[model samples]
Target: MKVTDIVDKLGLTVFSGHEGLGREVTGGYTSDLLSDVMGHAAAGSVWVTIQTHRNVTAIASLKDISAVIITCGEQPGEDTMAQSNEEGVPFLGTTLSTYELTGRLYSLIS
Candidate 1:
């Protein structure tokens, strides 16, 4: 599925890097541990996390993730949003919890 499709499916709102939502999303990864996320998240996957730090964007960059879904109704801070733009990573915010978001994303991206 495309990144934009996931956004629409989950009712997620784009925070930045909205233009990149047209990018392809091959899969989804749900995690909060930065190291684990970096090690396992596939390139062009949609990453669902509760993390709101700037390093989240850094790790997303390394993984080449298509988009970052900040779950549990969290919003990316200004610095995180800046880094996402710098890395061309699309950011989405939603009210869904981690597990719920994961399930929703999987149904759309799988």
Candidate 2:
């Protein structure tokens, strides 16, 4: 599924990086640790996390992720949004907890 498809399916909010809406989502990865995500997350995966720092966008770009989803209604940092837009990685938002969002995404993509 594409980022746009996942957003529609999960009722996620698109906060930035509109250019990457067509990016394909191969799977989902849920984590708050930057190192864990950097070492484990696969390219084309939608990353679910509570982290909203600018480093999140850096890691997303480095890993070639499809999108970043901020869970539990946490707002992303200004630099994070700017970097996301610059990198063309969609920055999404959700009110659901990390577990709930991961479960929903797993069912949709698996």
- What TM-score would every model get versus the actual structure? 0.94, 0.98
Clashes of 1: 0
Point out where model 2 deviates above 4 Å: none
Where does model 1 exceed 4 Å of error?
A: none
**Native-vs-model 1 lDDT?**
0.86
**Residue-level lDDT for 25 in candidate 2:** 93
- Please give, for residues 14-108, the per-residue lDDT of candidate 1 as tens digits: 99887688899898888889898878888988888999999988888888889999988899999989888888899999988998888877766
17 Cα displacement, candidate 1 (Å): 1.3
TM-score of 2: 0.98
- Flag clash pairs in model 2: none
Q: Residue 12 CA error for candidate 2 (Å)?
A: 0.5
Candidate 2: global Cα-lDDT? 0.93
